[model samples]
Target: DIKPIEQLNINNLINKRNFRGIFGTQPPLSILEEIDYIIVSPGVPFDIPIILKAIEENIEVISEIELSYRLSNGKIIAITGTNGKTTTTSMVGEIFKESRKDSYAVGNIGLPMISKIDYSTNETSFIVEVSSFQLEGIKEFHPHISAVLNITPDHLNRHKTMENYIDQKSRVFLNQTPNDITILNKDNPITFSFKDKTPGKVILFSRLSTLEKGVFIEDNQIIIRNEEKERLLVCPVSDIKILGGHNLENALAAVAISYYAGIPIQSIRKALKKFKGVAHRIERVDIISGVEFINDSKGTNPESSIKAIEAMEKPIILIAGGMDKGSDLSEFVLSFKNKVRYLILLGETANIIENLARGQGINNIKKVASMEEAVLFSFNIANKGDVVLLSPGCASWDMYSSYEERGNIFKSLVKDLRR
Candidate 1:
């Protein structure tokens, strides 16, 4: 059965298209008797009774990404990580577009891989942002260049363990060969460990240290090294406008993916200089009474929120807490010390965050009931040189349909707030 079960919005299809809905804890075995194979969405748990039953019966299972890989004619550049996937994928798409190549940034960045299949050609490039959920269903799906930006503790509710999550992310490299390129993060230990498991020639990107044969920052300049001992200076670090060290890693990954995909260094540099970053990702909303309002509702995990917090230059009035993802929030709370002046919380995990914040000696906390209330509360307490940030450390599903909706509401609320 669907976990929430209320997302069954198939009424139009059911009434006009004769579609059927069948689900239960244990659906009839007869249902699987005629099924040749099963294609499960990433949201469907593998441990479900029907899925386990199908496996026991020797039925094949694959994911949408696998299906798209089999059907599409384009080269794929798959990106996966706990964070930075969207920004990196978007940046790669812009780079390809700047180089005048046909590209579509699909998958977990909001567009479905299957929906864009008809638009693809041999010359087309698919810049896909994959997730552990989607990767769990992949079998033979492989990208020409697979980049794992970084892996941290996330989605523990479904995977239940860090190793399983890492294994799922590693599936992006399953079918690559020596001719393909795999880009990884040299700073994150988890993603750096994936180098040994990759079947292809591995390149790396780092914000922390220079690399012998990959993309890295050295002397405030982005550089790429080749096996021939050749080094190409890409751009200066100040050329990138995206905030945070995490975003620097994203930019590095995008550069590696785009450069290997045959985009000229000049085109990639032009795109990097103009790209301001994606929406709801540390996006600056407005300045009201000298307080900068920032929307980072897409920071749906503690690790992502920590990056947003670290990026702040001023004392922050942070708006956090949303649907719990079973993450250990102690670190999320601990990151608040020294930077955050006031913590305004809402949604399901507000109380949990309050307790955790108290334990960390962060006492300036306020609990509100709605996004509007949270914004007003933060506005009332914020001063000049303070930032009002909406960087929830949990998913938005508790009070909104998606993070985009949550971020939109926050932006609107901040826009309408009286001075």
Candidate 2:
């Protein structure tokens, strides 16, 4: 390890201090004056005082993605969007592995790209699940193939505006050339519009329509096309083990990325059939007394919870609410009109969601003080055919450190009920 910055004598630093080493957390704002470059992390807001100061002073700011790109000697397929990124990235990585390629699934999926750059060689492939936070600071971080699965109203609290968020997401392909590939969701109006702006060969994927030039479902089989000629048949949509139509869209995206990476159709199909989706994403926790309990704690925004709600075929008692991210709850509340028979809410946004539900004429709303209370209350009211879903439409930071913690607590509470 390098010498500690704390090793510098305070008196000497008072006389002549220069940056010495990394700050474990945030260094003193005074250190900003001595630094010439600041590589911002994704979690650090761009409007923070130090960042603003850097911008004012013309200090170079780049994301870890940019640093990794500069150091990489491998190919990258970066996936970004408001949702479906983790599932798609994992699927792509599995397909690459099945096809016998050296691949690492990094970025927002967990591992930082910067931590894995030295592990890359010419044959290594990186399947990155990027977020707008990471993209906002990128300068020349271009991927060999990039896909924006879909963009919706998400992270508005961070990016502040829908326009700004879209612009940041577009940076994924900003530096790509005609030799590279850009994948877009044809059904998403925002992402589909980027076809004209993409500098590379734009390929579109659709779960709702048959695309002339990308990937689409026809007769329940996933197919790919290029220049009006059908290239390959990936797997039958029904063969995908993941539940929901939303997952079908994710499958189409992963198939497009893996196939373009030269993975064979058989390998893609094999991966699709085996991949059972990621945890905390519409994951089935347990069933007791003929009632199903599903954990979707990863649904931290309105649009994501709406998808989870739409995927439910049985009557559901939804347990929602968490730290508010300044998302609109109108659409999310309205989605409960059909399937959600009972709404059990908790956390900071519980009252806010309950109010929205009442406005939508959803009168069966109950607010709880804790996750255990919410689960027990839901179990009390749930019928034999009803499903209890914990798809919180807000962040978990108000009560827990992460969504994973929230989901684990929910799972544990549900298991305790079984005993």
Candidate 3:
């Protein structure tokens, strides 16, 4: 009297460690009726029929993040946004380390948070880079300090609507109380509008505006004003190694979060000056034939790719396109038209991007089926002072294991070219 699992085979059940016995087809009515909990993977859509069925059956559904949160005793400082999450999370972890605290940065930055869980101590802190998919299925996944850096139009294909996407991102603060801190990007209109959404104490970080309680840049100094004390922590912005106005905002967010987590001002300053950045996010590879090659494979959204393009001082041979996540590439058209001297489109979104470029009257666009072809094409067209940048404004899942793998390939190809 067992029902079978639908759309899944024996291997799937075995891989999932479902030892209750999986039938070839839908399980028997008796087995289906007794089901209690359903764990959904990030790859499984929330709107899936099986999830709806589970809900109808009064079964509890949860994500891996929820499970991790339940088991973790460490102070969690979770980061989420369409972009810059990894860099900010890494920077915050560095700040904690500089303060001589036991801290580890993990999670969606490709290292699982569960893998870093130390059973030995209760003093360790975790800085996790979370995603919307991970946030979507949570039940009680609350972090001690949560920061939504910024949210743009992204992952629409999975969420099916922008509102749903924003709702998912807001889950980062779902279970927090007033004692917890919620840091937000005040400059991001979308994140700013969510000010009334969370019940936790709000701390705002901005690059364009001043905040009474959070961090901001004013008169060339990075300022952290204490709303409770009316005191200030100030440092020069030039001390930060990461470039771009966007990164300035990221640094501000990290500083606010780490400062609240008990990291001293001097430790924060030391981390800011010494921390370079996370890999594959505007990562400079090498100068081949005098053309600088940057592997920014983590810029999977148009907003992030635009930031990478904006950070470029030299003329760029922009490598873009991948599995389209239903993001609007039109947002980057002006940046590409101005900064990019050549466009090398790759992966599933190539034709769509190429058409968009052509529609915009851009003629220097070229399509290549693989990264090697794209690199060679870029190298052929790149001048001595120009840069060949792999800042694909789409996901790398279509062609490689992960964004890191895609970035490594670009680095390897660029190194081979140098040799």
Candidate 4:
């Protein structure tokens, strides 16, 4: 019999004396006895009770990412982090294309890796954007080059603790042997601390210091070095289309991976120079009445939003807030005082953000009900030489499908206003 868990509906409930049960609640005691394996989605938190019960019954539980990784045959370049995974993954894929290699980009960036299984061939290399949730259930999933970009406090609601989240992300290297390459952020405290834990060959990428075996920025030029030799005068960080220090770090990581993957330095430089950053990531929409409108809807955490704010040179009419993901707003408070001239809050987390801003002595905070309201409010508040930035520091699920949807809506509204 087939049964649906939670709100899912089951088509087949019972058959003859076999006796199957469809459960809206937790699986009944009888049904639990017959179950063999359980596939959990990222939305479902890893519960100790369920795991303990599964162990007691000798049943195996796995995640969808694990299943895809197991079935995948192509060489995988897996990228994981709190932010910049999608942009870096896309950049790496573009580099492969520029080098005339057959490549497919998949995983958490949008396309499910499993869906592209038929597209795979002996020549295809998969550039996968993985999340901590996806990393949790791997058994034998190993990438040719796996990168842990940077880990900040994110998804605390789902992971329940920072340690748990870090553990989940560390699984990307669980099955990796010494031959496999692990690209890590040398500047990130959390990722840097894992140098001793990783079994694979660790390659460091940094913007802070010069690295002997990875990519680093020194004198405005990106320098890439491996054990055998070094490649210098790569490109200027200023020439990169993507804004902010965070993106530079991302580019460094992507460059390190592409170079190690056998893509020529010329091809890598061409791709980096030509690549306009991913959408919803500091994408400039239009200039309205001398005010610059920017969309950073992908900033769904405090750290990301803080980075966005720091990237702004002019005074900002900042649009922020959504469904709270348990990130502290204290970091943004000082940024608001320094960079933001006005603050517009929207969605479920608006009041909380407003309160936080108010407590920080920021009097320019305004709470709005919808994205349109926030946009209009920002337009009214913004002046010549100022920026109207949508860098909501929380999830968009409270009012939109995803951060992409939120960004699209912001763009559409700005276009309508312009017309």
Candidate 5:
């Protein structure tokens, strides 16, 4: 131990493990002699002093995901995007479960990939939901199958530019060979541009149109065609229980990924029909006074929130705004033109979104300081059949530690309304 502490827990744990523990923000350079490679978590920025020092010292600095990838031995399917990554990853995991594969759904939405490495085997399947931050430090980390669901303007505050952000997301398929397969969103121009980027067999999924070879919706049914132009129908659009066209894309992605992995068509259909959805992304909470409450806290970006706004069938009493990530929310505001009845905003970007909404000639906006207030105001103004949606078009860092935390709090508040 290098620093004195009042608590014995951390010190005792360090002593019990018989390892050195440095408790300060900055460590002395003398300690560097024993340190070989520096492991960075996805949350840790590379520009920090210690990480920069490690880089300068020619030490191998890598993200925990990269380390996990190096140690993980399984048929890995890595999914990354600005949105729908969680849903898509979870869907793929469900498909694997139906097929009875010894699989683990780990990464951003579940356990850390590193934690599951010890449990992973040659026969195991790891459905990893990777983020741009996790992709930052990957060296030889490659997945057997990789999918970039869609690329949108997100995390610009960290990457500084759209190009750099895409660059990191692109890393998911960087080390794949021709033997591997990569699923790209054919409808997404940015992800579609990756058609020429990978050596892996490009499997495209589309909701708008049919593709020559890949997964697509045809005659309102999910279909896949191989290189030989042979078509296979998985299931009908009505079979999927998840809401939204965006979720339909996610379902198509899951099919593309699992079908390529050799899952039976029946198993794929079974999973698709049975798969509900992940929490915090357009999740139905409870209804009070005939008003529907939806938690779409996973809509951490404007593009994502736009989809959530579009997904609703009822007149929306939209609750949005969170930590500003310097995104163009004009489209976000514009999407609420005829759909959203009233807006209750909160968090850092509340004023910014409010001004944008007003500039667009919409004045039915209420600004609140907390989620409880946002929910109450929405409920107060909401009538029978109006949807109160908490689809924040920004990150949760302004108020909560994570989107899950923000969504949980909103759910708690909504459920409390019944009390």
Candidate 6:
């Protein structure tokens, strides 16, 4: 049975070509007779009653990316991680565009792979940014080049365990052969462990130490050494405009993915210089009364927010808390030491985070009802040279539709602070 969730636009759902008016709130306990195959979206948990019923009955269960991969003939450069997927995917997309290749960036970078399949040819290239949710249901979704940026605790509410989440993220390289490439981050322990497991050739990227054959920073220049031991200098680290140590990792992953995909060095260099970053990720919104405001509303988990907190140079008046995703916030609360001056909490997880902070001996916290109150509370407490960061460390589903909507609302409120 089809379940087009009620929260979405009904008009848009009905307008789909050849869409039959067949939707239900819940599936029958037994789907064996009528349903032979079920294509589940990433948003829906695989353990849901209907999908579990399909599995129990031996019905084929797959994801949209798996279906698109079966139908499309294009080369796929798929990247997945707890964070940095969007930035790396878009950076690789821009690098391909510089090469004048017939390529599209899809799969969670705002577009679905199936939608772009109709126009793709054998020569087409698809740079896909996949989430663990999207990767969880895959059976045969393979990419020509796959990169796992870093693994962290996210979507624990759905996956139920970090082990399962890591396995799902690793599935991006599940179908690869010896000819394909798997790029991994050396600094991230879980990601680096995959180097030995992958059948395909492995490429490593690091910010800490030099690699025998991978990408590394040498004398402040971004350099890559392939399996053939050929060294190529792409650009200086200064050429990268994106802030934070995490984004540097993203740039390294993008370079490895794009360069291995046969994109020219000149094109990669030019693209690296031109691409700033995707929105809602540590994006600087504005400054009011010498206090800066940043839109990191995309920081929907503790690890992501931790990175945002580390990226800031000035004292922070942080606005955090939203729909709890079952993440451990002890590290998030502990990191506030000497960094976060005031904590403005909102949404469903407000009390949870507040309690965690208080337990950590952090008492400079305020709980608010809405984004407006959070923004105003932060502004009132922020001083000159201090930054007001909106890194929620929780999903926006409790208060807003999406992270983008949350970020836009934060931006709108911050803009109004001037008035």
Better of 1 and 6 by lDDT: 1
Tens-place lDDT per residue, model 4, 1-419, is 12245334333443334754545445544545767877666665556466568867878778776777677667888899998999999999898999999888888888888888777776789999999887876677878888999999999988888999999888888888899899999999999987888898999999999987789988899998778765666788876888889999989999999988989989999999999988899999999899999999999998888999988889999999988778777786667877889999888888888888888888888888888998988888778999999999898988886899899999999998877
Those runs of model 3 whose alpha carbons end farther than 4 Å from true positions after fitting are 1-36, 118-120, 229-231
Please write out the lDDT profile of model 5 over residues 68-140, one tens digit for every residue: 8788888788999889999999999999999898999989986888888898799988899999999998998
Give lDDT: candidate 5, residue 311: 90
Alpha-carbon error at 27 in model 3, in Å? 9.8
Best by lDDT: 1
Candidate 2 pairs with clashing backbones: none
| Residue clash pairs of candidate 3 | 2-27, 2-28, 3-26, 3-27, 3-28, 4-25, 4-26, 4-27
Per-model C-alpha RMSD: 1.9, 5.0, 3.8, 4.0, 2.7, 1.9
lDDT of 1 by residue, 1-419 (tens): 44333566655765787544664345566889878888888778899877888899889888888889899988999999999999999999999889999989999999998998998899889999999988988888979899999999998989999889899899999999999999999899998999999998899888888888889989999998978878999999999998998998899999999988889999999999999999999999999889999999999999999999999999999999999889999999989989999999998999999998988888999999999899888888889989999999999988998999999999999879853
Per-residue alpha-carbon lDDT of candidate 2 for residues 1-419, written as tens digits (9 for 90 to 100): 12244643354654486646554355567877787798887878888777887888889888888888888979989999888999899999999989889989999998888788888899999899999998888888889999999989988888889999899999999999999999999999999999999897988899999877889999999999867586668777779887788889999999889877888889998989999889999999999999999999999998889999999999999999999888888888888988899999888888899888888888998888999899999999999999999999899988987899899999999999978
lDDT of 2 at 301: 92
Q: Deviation in angstroms for 291 in model 1?
A: 1.5
CA lDDT of each prediction against the hidden true structure:
0.91, 0.88, 0.85, 0.85, 0.90, 0.90
Instruction: Please tell me which model should have the higher TM-score, number 4 or number 5.
Output: 5
Error of 6 at 347 (Å): 1.7
Residue 167, model 6: Cα distance from true site in angstroms: 1.3
**Candidate 4 lDDT (Cα, whole model)?**
0.85
Return the TM-score for each candidate structure: 0.95, 0.92, 0.91, 0.91, 0.95, 0.96
Against the correct fold, how does model 6 do in TM-score?
A: 0.96
Q: List the residue pairs that clash in candidate 5.
A: none
